[model samples]
Target chain A: MKNYFSSQFKLGILGGGQLGKMMLYDTRKYDIQTYVLDPSNEAPSKVACNHFTQGSLMDYETVLNFGRKVDVLTFEIESVNIDALETLEKEGIKVYPQPSVLRNIQDKGVQKDFYKKHNIPTASYEKYAFAKAVKESPQWLDNLPFIWKSCTGGYDGKGVSVVRTASDLDTLPEVPCIAEKMIPFKNELAVIVARNVSGEVKTYPVVEMEFHPEANQVEYVICPARIDETVAQKARDIAEKVSNAFGHVGLLAVEMFQTENDEILVNEVAPRPHNSGHYSIEGSFTNQFEQHLRAILDLPLGNTDSKVASVMVNLVGDEGYTGPVKYENIEHIMGMDGVTPHIYGKKETRPFRKMGHVTIVDHNIEKARTVAEKVKGSIKVIAQ
Target chain B: MKNYFSSQFKLGILGGGQLGKMMLYDTRKYDIQTYVLDPSNEAPSKVACNHFTQGSLMDYETVLNFGRKVDVLTFEIESVNIDALETLEKEGIKVYPQPSVLRNIQDKGVQKDFYKKHNIPTASYEKYAFAKAVKESPQWLDNLPFIWKSCTGGYDGKGVSVVRTASDLDTLPEVPCIAEKMIPFKNELAVIVARNVSGEVKTYPVVEMEFHPEANQVEYVICPARIDETVAQKARDIAEKVSNAFGHVGLLAVEMFQTENDEILVNEVAPRPHNSGHYSIEGSFTNQFEQHLRAILDLPLGNTDSKVASVMVNLVGDEGYTGPVKYENIEHIMGMDGVTPHIYGKKETRPFRKMGHVTIVDHNIEKARTVAEKVKGSIKVIAQ
Candidate 1:
């Protein structure tokens, strides 16, 4: 209803990272003006957005001032100043995936508690105020090899560890944490759910995440998870339930675990586009970024069906390489059919840093998976 | 090989219109630095490019200066100053779709001459120094229904006319022009050929341009061209011959006329991305913009096969209104399955001004065409 296309409307975005950079592509397609705020001047989204402000997303006044200049406000990350978002909402500025939804998901303990309160199926967990308390309690010691996750400020595998023995407790951080029962899982799966302002909701196909055997990092994300029809349906149903419980606008990516008995348990959820859905860029009829924009704008959602099977492999920096980044054999992999590499433009390449991703699409899922493995083996993100 | 991805390599572009704006998306995906030069500060590519220089692309000094700042140079429009491109090439700047190729295609007369010299099939045409010369010649008087086209500086349906009567000559511009014998044709089609610097060549599938019955404007561009396979192969073969003859190092869109007898004759050619290939954005394995980048960068080209059937409908401003632009019913059309609207970011709307385009993709060509018609009928570009 608002003249958002090629008009005077401005959409302000917090956190100018890769997600913001990808989102800017869709904004550009619609010719919608956008302003981005990030701490780094060299942020990936700096060039693509209409205006880029170098500021902290966590600073209250900074975000508040930024939000005042736009018609609608949104964020690509969850580490923003929630107080500023609440103040902006009070001042009548539209902020999607409302601040309350973010507040509930930001802290691990609170997120798990919300899942329980909403009758969402999740792994059993015990909360503690501090790691010392967990170590002193006999109950936690009895459950050896449990999952230890910090209640706050954890990201990208940080502040999370598998406590195999009591010695692992000594390495834990002195912060509020959650000790979760580690159930043996057959596969790690995820589903991305989109909810519009009008309450219209849709969920992408369940994607199966294949992790590296040694690194414990996700190596490939395959869409239409190779599972029984009933299992996939159950996953989508649970993901929709999670989205309905949150009543969040925009995209909600729900990560779940399919146990040996085929029961789907919620692992966690991201309030924005997740790596699990990156394959949608080339595989699905509507990409997650564009769908997120449509949902946030309250426009009708696009088709969620896949035009082709797709597998996405992350291009992380090789070990012992920590300098200016270089993509070796990228051209070779590109020469292969249906392979597309998306470099994030980070410039530097520290070990295990996510520099980019490559998507392999084919009419057959098995062929796509094979090409994905070839892509992963052929291209190396290394130092120059 | 030159570390163009997220490195020090800089790519310069002339004429920052919609083509450059779309190309910038691929550049951003690779983290390639870019500089764009256009006469308007409101150029669509002004925000997406790394550097924006407001200057005349036709001014030799201005183009030369802009070209000197980047490691490689290209143009979205062929109207750029060729002398500057020649100088840049001499100065060791990599210019794709070489200046010689552009020179051969920039003028209609010269382009026709090249086709004749190469034994390419085309409509017979007689060159004239001025409109009076065309009128004074007895041979022209016999062909009352011939088409009149200006030799140079013609674009967007300007500098062209259908001389149905002797009195129609009075309205023609007194410039170097050509009187082309209009051949009866069954269809207007196009093929996009991409050639890298290494001489590796590939051609996209043929696309048919369906004109409006009354307005005579192009209404839809259908991919795979609903024609016999033999005809499509013939069109692609002819397109490849054109690319090979020119030795172009980027995308060359070859427009052709399929006569009533199934004979394909070269109509014209564009040295950069063309509107006929817009459907590839959602239809083909590799979109035209990305293909252009890969060809110009001398990188391996991606597959040119179509992933699905697609039809593109242009969104031109309505005749009755002329002022600030508004896209009426855009949201309604977006609700259609597999419909994607690309707004060009132009704030004003004048009669027949190309504001944007919509791409409808489907597994079935007929269904895609049907959806395209619905999209065309539903959305209206007008002034507020």
Candidate 2:
């Protein structure tokens, strides 16, 4: 009962990226005042937020100063200075998805260790102090085809690689890292769990991430993951358990893999709105951004059911294009039924850059998938 | 072809009210830069747009200056300076729902005349230069009860009244006005027609406005009106005809009356997004705001079909409350399934002031309606 809607309540968001931009839409809907911090002056959220500060999110003083100005604080990205968040928390500023939870999740090594401590099912992994340790250990040759992930600073497709050969270990960065046994998976699935300060919790329907046949990238995110009901239910249960373990407020998107034998193993989790839930903007009764707001505000959460099945395709910069962004054939995709493209307002696009996303929705999941394919094939993010 | 997305192209909007605020959401989604001008610095759209100017929308110089700064110009409210818009259009600034179309719809007398000229079905009405003309003519007494509407500068139930008694005529404002024969109607319906600059047109499903039995005010707006399919089709056809008659580029929300004989009579039309279509945000495949952007930009029009049944209840300020606004029991409504409230960000409350709106969407129309009633009965927009 803080009168958060259309009142003087200030919500400060760290890292004004695409996620923060989308979150601003909901804040605007509720007429809540918002301030955003990002290093770039042209951050996607700069225009939408009530105030925009250009500063490094990783700078302790910058983060602390921004946190002090708001009634409640949250972050769209995990790379923010956690020590500042702890200081703000000590001063009674409400920081959702608490700093402790972020501290645990910010490093892959700590996150994996937390999962093991909580008895959460995950791919077996070994934490290494540095990539040199794995290179020097001849015994590591036994676990040849493992996944090498930089313990910190890994994002998108960066800082992660598959070590199938001895030379692959040489290519690893000199940072704290983890090598996990690669579990063959049938499908990559995800569940977005929302938990409020009052302990109210809900999970969105399991979504399946369909990978490109040859590109080895996520091609489509289909809601209600064309999987067995039992598997989907198990995913939701596990996601809720993860939420409880973190005691985190706001949204937690838990990514997992469905093993060939049908075992569900957690891949990782983002304690904020994930790209996988971008489809919810048009697909769910309550979009993930709005749900995150509800969770952080401790208001009653909206229904998580989808009005129609949805499929989302990320619009990345086309290869060999690296200048002012141009969305080619965008109008062609716009003509397709139930297609909505969300441009992230990034003026420039480089190869594989996360430029935007398009969502296709229909009553029939198959029809939605078909239209999503057309949308994916037609629209290309290129240089002007 | 203009590369509006994340480009140099700018969209200018007059009257930064709730409609403009909602439209801003779509503009943000598309990363389309926008400039907004409103008389009040606290306009809901001020924070969201790329640039905001506090200036009178009806002032010729103010509107012209703002319009000159952008490639295209539009308005959320109809009372903007049309002469300025005409000048901008002549200067090659695309003004959507065209300045000419807005000119016709801006005045009640001219709008009614255009309907007659275009052979559109509408209520029989007589235009008078002044209220004194109707008062001095005793023969008007024979007409008895009728609807009195001011020819210009009327909005949100203001400047419109039911003239049933002699004193009611005295209460009328001394201005250009219209007297329409009251036609007993079964339901007041609306159809939102979207027409792009290229002349591509589409219509949303008819929505029925259910009024409060005693208050005689619209209480709920239900989509896919619970009427015969033939009647609904007629309403849509008439709306399209109205859109075609104006050759309007953008959204024209045609409000109609489904008469006792199932005839559809055009009551009026809004050349921009209207309150009746607010439910589309949660119900339709593409909401009206996004559709308006597509039409104005001349991009392909989106699907207008509803994904689920929806009922919208306007959250007007409670009687006898006129200070800082507080939404009582809003949390109760938020707890309801499929309920989403959109606060307009107006800080003050006056009797019957439109503070916000709540939309309830469900797979079943009846269930949505039931939830809408619960939402209406629970939330009260009042002063703290």
Candidate 3:
């Protein structure tokens, strides 16, 4: 085995967000040298890595130049330049999750096709160059109440809309997009699957995503989703199948919709550490970020079992509060047992902005959920 | 409570050792800005903090200058300049474990006297101006096999020696020192007491320090020391007494010797995170480093209860190896259940140097110990 600890071995990370910051906890543990690149100099990962380069991840030349200086390159965000990763791979540098997987999943048009080809369970969707073209489709009009999603640059409900009529389509942005038959699902669940370079695989327990009633944003993520054991097993199995099909090295967070009749259908997947797995930091035997590093390096995977049942509450910026961030009553919540809040180093607070997250772990999932609600209610991410 | 997260609030740490690096994990979690100072630019904490300043922690001006830029000041090492801490305290920099506590425990003779004055139990000892004077004294000469420790500047068994004969004293430096009667103890145990500025106190479970027979260095730190419940209670009570007596504001690692008759005698104390408490990182509800930061910040102290039994094995550099460090077969140990290695980020290795540590955790202490032995046997720190 190659010596990666306390040596000249360099691990390059393509994004310097909180995911990369969390990964550094494990990298620093092994004393592995790291070079991180992100578009912002104020990125959360800037301080924890050996080298921090501020550059566009989508700019081919910038990514290629950064990738050339490191031995093994991986990314926290999948939006990075796949062409640069391909060049790095050709030059004998290791690119985890392989650039082809990112390219296949980068566009919803292509990703949906790949899923269909692999016999993956997903909602049937129609692609369009513009919202008017999608509206003009007679077949899509017949299938009313479809989900209109921008093919690219969509995150956290920003580029998604539940279109109920032709007028909803009229207000939609003129961007390349996909219109999918909206499923009246019973629940939105997620499973995190880890695949190493050596093809070893492990999956975390299924998690139930509780969304805000009005905003439709994930408010709480409860692990060991309060679903049937068989359904949980099926979710995990499908997640593993998805990971195997992609042949992605590192973590693949599979988001799925659990239909009213209990059929699990894939919604999407992120090829890096995902928000849904944040509870792993306090609940599981190994956290998602650490697991990603282990998988990327092809190290023996750790036990994916949960040491304790856990719940995660996202700390988004309070509505109508947009300035320097302040986590009010954070100490009151911290006084509770097993409550850990992760402040994402983002200094500002804007309505609906991702500020941080809180993990509450307990031997009893119900008790953890109870505390999570208390945590969600007690702290306010406001402008001080 | 003061909002230290993502603001101008700065926490200044005087030493840049592994302890500070571990503390940064919690600080970074809260997005609290920190300034770390160390003599070496290659200190383990350099990469993890917002600011890194190269300066002598022992130099009054250097420490004061660094302390002036932060809202709160703390140190990982106890050998820092006490006078500088005093100045910082007077200036309201909120130095934890106040400089008076450091001054009282700065000298071995003074520490022993404080213990005696406070009615704290300890072994009988004598203080000498020099090693020759210790040997020349008739009464000290009568007491052979006493432990000779330099009154000041002793660390990691370097300034300590077991004086059995006149020849043993010949090689010692002529410095102010102390001679203590060596007592046969059943076990060497430690209890880390965390006290907040609010005067709240909590003690961790007793840990047994297993030493290398030849090197006299701690090889394994086993938490929840295999001892009687009453004895464990006594150890914790005494540790609390020590913390209260010194009015310490952060973690005070109180090392003790358990006599054959189950008598607990104080050996020494460190005012910051201690090696014996390293197992808490994996075993306890809240790790020692995080607890230290919470205590200093006057935040409610976290639970000190054990989540799992754990054993920490130090990864000291193997004898006759002195170059870039390498952990041979690290992957082999990573494959084991509940094993985590913390590399100190020191690139070079020499015999008996503390390069890193591996923690083995299990629900059962016996199982953890068995796995710890396997971990200790499988991995070796060597020069490349």
DockQ top scorer: 2
DockQ of 1: 0.84
- Candidate 2 residue lDDT tens string, B71-173: 9888999988999999999998889978999889999999999999999999988899877677765656687888889999887777887888778888778
RMSD of each: 1.3, 1.5, 1.7
For model 3, report DockQ.
0.73
Residue pair clashes in candidate 2: none
Cα lDDT of all candidates, in order?
Answer: 0.92, 0.91, 0.90
Once model 2 is optimally superposed onto the true structure by TM-score, how far is the C-alpha of residue A117 displaced, in angstroms? Answer: 1.1
Can you list each candidate's DockQ? 0.84, 0.85, 0.73
Error of 1 at B120 (Å): 1.1
- Proportion of native contacts in model 1? 0.84
> Against the hidden reference, what TM-scores do the models get?
0.98, 0.98, 0.97
* Per-residue C-alpha lDDT of model 2 across residues A1-384, encoded as one tens digit per residue: 668887889999998999999999899888899999999999999999999999999999999999999999999999999999999999999999899999889999999999999999999888899876887766566878878999999888678888998787777788999988899999999999999989999999999998655345677999989999999999999999988999999999999999999999999999999999999999999999999999999999888989899999999888899999999999999999999999999999998889999999999999999998888878889999
Error of 2 at B155 (Å): 1.1
